[model samples]
Target chain A: MDENPATAPLPANGPLDGDPGLQPERTALAWGRTLLTLIAASAMSLRWLPDQGPFVLAMFGLTIAAGSGIYLTQRRRYRRSVEGIRAGRLAPDAAAVFWTAGACVALGAVGVWLVLS
Target chain B: MTVPSTSTPPPGSVPRRSRFAEKILPGGTEPDPRFTLANERTFLAWIRTSLALLAGGIAVEAFTTDVFPEPVRRGLSVLLLLLGMLLSAGSAIRWLRVESSLRSNRPLPLPLIGPLLAAGCAVAAAVVIAVVVLG
Candidate 1:
């Protein structure tokens, strides 16, 4: 077992080999940008909702809730990635992708129905 | 040549020189900076997609009313709002998955959203056509 943390075997080939810190920083920044975008979009949705006040409010509420989840999840993800790199064991994350894709499809379907009906 | 770890390599590692090297090349060593950048770019692309969906929802809710019935307009507004929420949620989830894969050094997970998105778009289009043709 490599005693040196710096030279410790990586769990997987992550982005930063030379400087382990750099990749994590980039990933964090990416998440930050994503968070900002979602927040802005949510604000727009809240403001633009029409005469159907309750429905619009409900949707906006959900957006805010989801945004909070994203913010928290991103932070946790950064920490976990860092840990995985340090420990030398790669953890799998397929569930997140599946959830995201499913959500997108559902949203698209709902949007289209709204537009046409 | 024994290179000092203190100094960074110029860029991407030298191309894989052997079959075993190729297998390890993709997952054996820490990912390259370029890979990180590429992953981030992919994430941003997904975010853009989500934003577009959000914008689309808002646009449909606001503009379609000019030509649609009152019930239809209201329905569209609700639907668009729901869509926006869905996009935001989806993008966040996707980001998490990508980040995890990058850290683990495993093969990037296959995207499952493509079919769902395509199907959703198809359904939406059909509904729009029906509305236009029936009206």
Candidate 2:
């Protein structure tokens, strides 16, 4: 909640009372946690990585790339979020969200295949 | 998968009413940012579950399956992995749906996948038990 009595028009400012558009910050943190989980899962799955030659290795590379992309974009996302917050028109980060989910789906598919084998 | 961050609505930019935005967002108005953030958190929560399921699936095969008969073990692992895949995809779709609702000032959509997940797991558990008992 915004403790700033000086700020005008509370409801217009953000969703919650007194919150000065903290959505971006919160979303960025969520992104951080998501990326961390992905990386941890990826690392944990390493031991389980199938030795099916190049295909499995490719999976490993793709997973790492997803992690890297998330990592590299962290700051940029936060920056854009802040900008959006101030602009009073936050554009959605549909791409990043979808990408992260897609990566997990791919990993899950691979995991399923691994199990079936 | 990336939402194009290219649209910069200038402060107090004329509220442009378009069929596209109207179709995506529910209330016909831009939602408070907090709701958007909440939607994002929900999406991440789903993704976390997916990741957990994926890890669990692999761990089942890699570590826990030694005692299980080959087919039983493989079946369980596959089930978990499939669940993960479903969760991951479902979460993404739900995220988009909620975001649109928030944009339109519509009531947030309750997740449809929760019950499906519960039922899916129950069915899988039933299979697991039957495989062990009947085999």
Candidate 3:
């Protein structure tokens, strides 16, 4: 409690419990893995560029944008999670889960179109 | 029933969170942060599974152009893609249900997605194997 809330530095290894390296770290890494999988799916869409022309590029763009949104906010999320844990009020982020689902649906639609057309 | 708290809060009070959050957050007593975090990880795992399915669909379509007949390949690819879409959407619902259950101290819901995914993948594999054996 002595450390100023605003000025307290983030943990070097990432925000984790005093017990050291557990739940929060695992969750953070899960997000990271999800981001990587999304990027891989996005890149795979590029293989359709020649076959589907520019339409497939849109899928790539949308998928990458979604991935970027998650990537950029990761640090903020980690910080909030640590603070929420300490305060005993971890707010569940339904929007993040929903938007990720939406992005996957979009990607799947695009893939189906590419395959069928 | 109690009246909503409409009176203005004192200065420096934490503002109310979004309506979306209010709906989900107000119902359950606060669960352990670690449990909440674990739930988040499970949701992320499902997302990854969806992405993996999408990647498989793309790879099948992109690389198997000559291996399987056009109609057969397209059918398999579309099947996988649709499953990917289904899983991604379902996982979000699953996450919410689990969170709510945790809050209310109910037993966690059975993951209906598991059987659906297994069946979908099995069908896709069977189609591939049939094509390989027949043609």
* DockQ values of all predictions: 0.10, 0.31, 0.42
Which structure among the candidates has the greatest TM-score? 3
TM-score of chain A of each: 0.63, 0.73, 0.81
lDDT by residue for model 3 (B1-135), tens: 121122333323322345786676677665665677888899999989988999999898888878989888888888999999999999998998998899899999999999999999999999989998999
Worst 10 residues of 2 chain A by lDDT: A2-11
- lDDT string for model 2 (A1-117, tens) is 532222233354535232454666777788788878887776655765455646566777888899889889988866655544444455566677778998999988877776565
Model 1 pairs in collision:
A11-A88, A13-B29, A13-B31, A14-B31, A114-B76, A117-B72
Instruction: Order candidates by DockQ, high to low.
Output: 3, 2, 1
Candidate 1 per-residue C-alpha lDDT over B44-102 given as tens digits, one digit per residue, 9 for 90 to 100: 56755666666666566666656877676565455545545565565556555655566
**If scored against the real structure, what TM-score would every candidate get?**
0.49, 0.76, 0.86
Q: Which is the leading candidate under DockQ? A: 3
On a 0 to 1 DockQ scale, where is model 3?
0.42
Off by over 4 Å in 1: A1-21, B1-44, B63-135
TM-score of 2: 0.76
Give the alpha carbon lDDT tens digit for every residue of A1-117 in model 1.
754433455557544333444555676676566556655554554544564467557655665665576677887766555543443332333343334444445444544543454
Name the better of 1 and 3 by DockQ: 3
| Docking quality class, candidate 2 | acceptable
